[model samples]
Target: MENRQTEQAYSLYKPLLFSLAYRMLGSVMDAEDVVQEAFFTLYKSGSDHIHNMKAYMCKIVTNRCLELLRSTSKQREVYVGTWLPEPLVTTASDETDPMQSYLQKESVTTAYLLLLQQLSYVERAVFLLREAMQYDYDEIADIVGKSSANCRQIFHRAKRSLSVKGVSDTSDRSDLEKATNLVEQFMHALTTGDAARLMKFLSIDAVLLADGGGKVKALTQPLHGHLSISESISSVLKKWPGSFTCRIAMVNGLPGIVVYKDTIMWSVFSFMIRDGRITNLYFVVNPDKLTHVQ
Candidate 1:
């Protein structure tokens, strides 16, 4: 393809490609890098024989992500404390962001991405291509260089695993609004130290998980039970220095909070709401993972 055609292809597919990469790798920096590298490769190729620019570019990005996952597996195995995906912090003004536009909030969510991490890299690529991108099995097979039958099996296995994890579908508009309101109320209750109000918002079995990446103070283990989680939140708030302020933002495509401690980004909170109550709370405080928000 000519330079002009390649540029057009980049513009048309950048969002989709970036979304795929981000979901695959769960790192904003890595996703952006791999997508740029794919475009550069396409530009350098200057091959007119490539008839389908989208598929060609997708194959490039997917293979690159698979390679990255393999290389980084050791680092992840040794990661400090609980690991969390880098938060894709978005505000109302970010509506124009091509990547955010292409992303399905349900797929990019922290919970969903974490579940994706459970799959092998090849399964991840095939599953994402089939589920998020709506590619047919034949299409996914070509991208991942797997047989069509194998791709189909991989997609089903991945889907079954996620379903077993009780993945909550966030596609319902009313459910999303309810969750957003709960987040707002939860934030207010947190600031007010209203244990009673907080209890009402949490399921009896709610679990709290924190990620500090060993760079800062964080919980090394998951906290369970609504009562224990509530008490822990109150205790932590009382001990933390400085005045706290939180802004409700779209975190991983759901209504969540970006908390600041005297103007420094302290923590990013994402909730998994089920049955009108929070079932899981994710707190990411690692300074390294929060550079984007800072």
Candidate 2:
């Protein structure tokens, strides 16, 4: 293919390919690297004989992500504390399809990505392709180099492993408004050190998971129950100087907060809000993971 054609192809498919790899690998940096490698492969090999560029690019990116998955298994196994997906700061575009927007939200969530860790690489690939990407069984099989029947089985197994209801429509205006208000209140209580107010918004079974990646001071284990979570937050507030600030912002397409000490980002807090209460709180303090947050 000519240079102009390759550039057009890259511009057209990069977002789709990056989204696929990010969902598969759960790391923005890794996803970018994998997508770049896919484009490099295409550039070097030329796309003259490839009739369908999208399918070819998808296959290449999926295979590259699988390779990274196998290589990073040990690293993830040795990662310190609770691991969370890298939070992405994304805004929905007006031209995006409704179904695609919903799927994107479902796939990028910390809860959903953490569940994906249980599946094998191929199983995860098949599941994401079939569910998030809306690929048919035959198309998924072609991408993963498996029979259509095998792909279907893998996808079903993945679903059973998740064992959850379908992804809900999170764009509901009422829910969004409620979540935003709760998030604001939660942040206010945290910054002001009002444990009583903060605890009110937390569910009785609220859980807090912090990821420090062994490079920062963070909880070495998951904090469980509302009391534990509240105490943990309170303790941190007491120890932390008043200079640190928390600002409400979008994280992984949901209401969240970004923490900053002075001018530098210190951490990010993403919550799972259900019925006007915070169910799960994910604190990603690992500096490595916060690089993309700003």
Highest lDDT, which number? Answer: 1
Tens digits of per-residue lDDT for model 2, 207-261 = 8999999999999888888887887788788786586788887676677889888
lDDT on C-alpha atoms for all candidate structures: 0.87, 0.82
Q: lDDT for model 2, on a 0 to 1 scale?
A: 0.82
Q: For model 2, which pairs clash?
A: none
**Candidate 1: Cα lDDT at 254:** 88
Every model's TM-score: 0.93, 0.92
The C-alpha stretches of model 1 lying farther than 4 A from their native spots are 104-106, 164-166
- Tens-digit lDDT string for candidate 1 (45-72): 8758788888889999999999999999
* Worst window of 10 by summed lDDT in candidate 1: 162-171
